[model samples]
Target: MKLLAGLTILMIVFVVFGIHTQQQILGLASDMQEMVPNISREINNENWDAARNDTARLLEQWNEIQDRWDLFIVHSEIEQVELYIARILSYLSSEDKAAALAELAALNTQLSHIYRKEMFNVQNIF
Candidate 1:
């Protein structure tokens, strides 16, 4: 009876922790997603300076959450985001609007994929 009670309590804790992890992942991903569009718009308007600054800010935010993100997400996903940011920065420096926008789109897709993959749904459970 004591062992059963302990196992039940452990299971409850695990479930709660899983939910908390999901929330953190969703929040961090959403924060990054919100910034992507602004950068894209800046690029579209040919505002190189603004786009550069925003991209820098996005990189800063990513760095800040990176360790925390690693705790809940795959390292490859994090690496992909970092790669996209680097490419975007390079494209921005060269004022290559097309390349920068394409990178931003890829970054957005990667972020979306990260959050969706982490979501606690039936698809993930199987």
Candidate 2:
């Protein structure tokens, strides 16, 4: 029947949309994750100026993705990442390299968590 065919089409579209949404979210997380190593290198080299600049750039990227993700993801998890960024910024301002690097590591973990939570897996669905 035409009705049955139409319903199947609609269901297919819905499933595709859900998968696409998760891909976009994961893509954003990947972008953030990519920045980790460069920031870590800057910190290790004691290039405070460059590290600060990179962190600022990373924060900007985070803001750009944050709004898009809000619709699909948990707000509190997002907040935790924002908090980590703020803490990193604070440490940078005080020229505390060790503390800033620690915060950076924490930020990486938070980003990974967000990515894993959004991944299209059975565990995440429940």
**Candidate 1 residue lDDT tens string, 15-76:** 99989988988998999999998999999999999999999999999999898888767799
lDDT of 2 at 126: 85
What are the runs in model 1 whose C-alpha is more than 4 Å off?
A: none
Shift in Å, residue 82, candidate 1: 0.9
State which candidate has the highest TM-score.
1
Best by lDDT: 1
Per-model lDDT: 0.94, 0.89
TM-score of each: 0.93, 0.87
Model 2 per-residue lDDT tens digits across residues 1-126:
999999999999989998999899888899989998998898889888888899899999999988988887889998999999888888888888899899999999998998898887899768
